[model samples]
Target: MKDMVTPTMPVFEDMLAAHDRIAPHIHRTPVLTSAYLNGLSGAELFFKCENFQKAGAFKVRGACNAVFGLDNETARRGVATHSSGNHALSLSYAAGRRGIPCHVVMPRTAPQAKKDAVRGYGGLITECEPSTSSREAVFAEVQAATGAEFVHPYDDPRVIAGQGTCSRELIEQTGGLDAVIAPIGGGGMVSGCCLTLSRLGPGTLIFAAEPEQADDACRSLRAGRIIADDAPETVADGLKVPLKDNTWHFVSRHVTDILTASEQEIVEAMRLAWQRMKIVIEPSSAVALAAILKNPEIFRGKRVGVIVTGGNVDLDRLPWSAG
Candidate 1:
């Protein structure tokens, strides 16, 4: 495993603070182990079930911490963010908890369920062009028009610290993991997960699982640069962002490896998990299982931990299948 950074980043203390700040709002989600999944993957597998988290995904942790940890004046001004789905819902829920209004800038192409969730949670939605470059412009307009504070999706220290608490709880629950694999999109989960493991569980190999079509993180890590995701296409709508500087900054320091999984592999893994394990996993989260299934040798003999990061698959439309 290569050191992803010259100096280990100090994200753990903030994660600890996040754990304390958002403790009452966030769920200490359970760590589930599957004898069948372990045997199938040829490794002892511990699934940190954030799919069961508040907002039905791990986004709420960061969203809650970032929302609640804000000073009263900032909270009073309200908050705004851009997301495909989970982040919007999480932001809405977190803001609702704090008695503040949330403005969510979502891609028009974002899942209808996610859009509905945002509205269901009382979020005010402003639809935008799905591109990263334009989303910022749209958010800026919304923030200015609404006079709302911005809560960045993945690149903020506060949000990243909040996300780290998920992995912290996972490490605490499992105790010893030879390797931990998390699916990466915008790098929030991996950034935080890496920070926690680097500090508390130093020996844990942190692997990032990414969709092959949306393999920007793999490219960014290899090139040590942030690559734009030009005309990206993937079933994992959540894993759409190009790597952020802060995310890549942490990736360079803590990630042990970046693995790519095919669309077919991702779909099959999602189906199998739902049918066999009865776990409804989103395509982004299913990337972890997909990677394990496709390249078993890399993880076969190791004690591996995977974040079943979310369960918010729209259930209306399905991913491409093996048949």
Candidate 2:
């Protein structure tokens, strides 16, 4: 088995570099506000609409950084990783732009919309069982066969630095914020928020939102150690992965709290965003809004930045319409 490379912790400077490197490949996603949501939650929320991002998700930021940063020889070999959805498609998008082959190992249970998007962007897929162990095992085989440079979904410094660019844009767009909240799956986006906010907006409180069913990150924060669940199930399919040491470094140090909401709450919030904000966001993206509504005291009267992470939902199987 090829050994996984340990990613170095990213510094604020690295984020700056990543921003410049990936500027051409990504969108400076807009920040939007809804008065009704503000009245309901008592927080002035600025939604960073990464759902409008290229490839339909924020994961492209990290994937672009990893793919573009590679040297010619390494780039020629292509790139590979395992993701539930967003990262897989994001990597494929980035690799396609670079004219390189992208291989991905995704859970068989991942949203079909995401799988289709991956293929649409020219990625070759290898399916695995919906568990971390199976993903790793299958990814190892794919990596060996393809000899692709593995760009781990969230547990990579290049990826984290790339994800940090979202918050950097948030801070610049908002002037400043009292707090920033984003869905935490493998802690990539949250860790990126931590990496950026700690330096650029030191006073900003960083919060991670998660599905109650897949709340290992929340539990890990409380335990003061990593707590991983291999095959946790949740409506926020994109957030089922566990946090790794690379992300845990920022999450453990800078995150003010980790919040969770029930499956029903996430569904309701997803529907509410579509109804009120008229924006299409996935269950994973809705987790942050659900957490804010469930715990209004933490966010009330404050200027909060909410990262609306993605819009890649299976329209035929909307969570709210499920029987």
Candidate 3:
């Protein structure tokens, strides 16, 4: 409830500072390519392989910045957050690095591998029903009981600043790009990309990719306001959350467009990445690739950067396994 108030927007400078602040703790995840995939899409696609990041997702960058950027006194209370999965594990990993307690509220339906990863990083997990209201209610209780500093998975300024570092690295690594595409869950990564690319790579167009099953971001963009969705069924579980106020600010202002892909297309893209690029990417990350492949005319002959947001998958619950 407190976080619902639109927080002050983090500027480009904050992203720069966060990039430096979190650089040592996190990986400058590599930019990868698949020549075969590029030929298929008719674009020179550079995949920022955040799946190989410390917590197996790009969420680590934001979590690390939020944890480490805190004052010593504040951080002593440790950190608390609610996530579908990756952010929980990433926040836990960051807190563990800071030698502090981490509390997490995760959806009951979240993949077991992500739950295990959170525990592996020493996060105390509290399960919540897989819905927005439930996650918020459970997280409120966890925050109150633990007296923890809340690090929202995607809404906070520090987290956005941290996420911006991803694009900063992408721009530096690839020199220049015609466009950048990132999945829009709560819009943290795309907002970060918007923030960073607006300042550091102004010429580059920013696109937000979303699952058609949970196309709230796309709808919000078209409606020119935030449109909250309760629960949407999609294999891209990480993308079920809707955009918050802070994230909406960046998304509405800087993002060029929001594109969506069907669940089948998302799965196909995920498998294609694994098969062609030899990289494991979660379904959420596949959303961006799906968008590109589905709309080749928009990306043809352009040098595009796609944020491969995460790689954490439950081996027993692979998308194709559900028959």
Candidate 4:
């Protein structure tokens, strides 16, 4: 593993500013509870349903902040990013709301529904091979041609601040929580949770959930360094990326522990959420629930908040349909 530097993280005040800046644009998605889920896990579970958010994912909050934060000239130049799915659509949605051009570099293997959503939002899509290097290289060319501001999916300060608002709302709405758990892809949402809960909910423990197939964050947490996996495969497609410097900074310091669940567990958890909670959540969101189910002792008799990050599933290609 390479040495990692701790990047400057967003503060509670940044989250406050982000909440205000994007208040009019994004939804303050509801915090829902389920009797069956709580009973099964032996914990009081509060689900922050970001799946109901605009663009069907929590990525919109960050995208809106980054797009709206730009001044006139920069906004005119537009914004650009490389994302496999939700961020692409979210950035496009934000840029569309601002009436500015948005350029996105997306993996060719990304779900067609997500690609369609990006186009529906008027984002110019450039296809890249499903690898980090290919995406970065193509994005460089796109940025050079358009002079677009690079709004990284997880690493940027504004994006991190925007993501922090989710946890801020959870803290305020719930009064208090014993612990907060969120699925970690690039560690954006988890980092945001860390930022808010560390300062505001000081007594609350922060835990990160991940798929066993893409467990770099869990490994990184244990190894005490950043670990970048070179294109790990998982049904939770949104979570294939590794933690960047900005996200790693918060994850390293504040997250109490990282847990992972297998593909079977993720699918079962997704089914359970839809069956019991009467909500549609993508597989990535279920990782948080799966983690809790697989580790009953950790959350036993505690009030835990779980962040459901998205609901952008392709109806035709449902993971449970594998039967």
Best by lDDT: 2
Overall lDDT per candidate, in order of appearance: 0.85, 0.93, 0.91, 0.90
Q: RMSD in angstroms, all models? A: 4.2, 1.8, 1.8, 2.6
| lDDT score at residue 300, model 1, on the 0-100 scale | 86
What ranges in model 1 sit over 4 Å off? Answer: 1-10, 107-111, 129-137, 320-323
Measured on C-alpha atoms, candidate 3 has an lDDT of: 0.91
* Candidate 2 lDDT over residue span 89-142, tens digit each: 899999999999999888899767667788999999999998768988898888
**lDDT of model 3 at residue 45?**
98
Q: Report residue 309 deviation for candidate 2 (angstroms).
A: 0.4
Better of 1 and 4 by TM-score: 4
State how far residue 265 of model 4 sits from its true place (Å): 0.4
**In candidate 2, which residue pairs get closer than 3 Å at backbone N, Cα or C atoms, i.e. clash?**
none
Q: Candidate 4's residue-wise lDDT over 1-323, tens digit each?
A: 01111145678898888889999889999999999998999999999999999999999998998889889998999998877588988999999999999998888897777778889989999999987678778988988899888888888778999999999999889999999999998989988888788888999999989999999999999999999898799999889989988898899999999999999999999999999999999999999999999999999999999999999888888888867
For model 3, the stretches where C-alpha displacement exceeds 4 angstroms are: 4-6, 107-112, 128-137
Clashing pairs in 4: none
Query: Candidate 2 — number of clashing residue pairs?
Result: 0
**TM-score versus the correct structure, for each prediction:** 0.92, 0.95, 0.95, 0.95
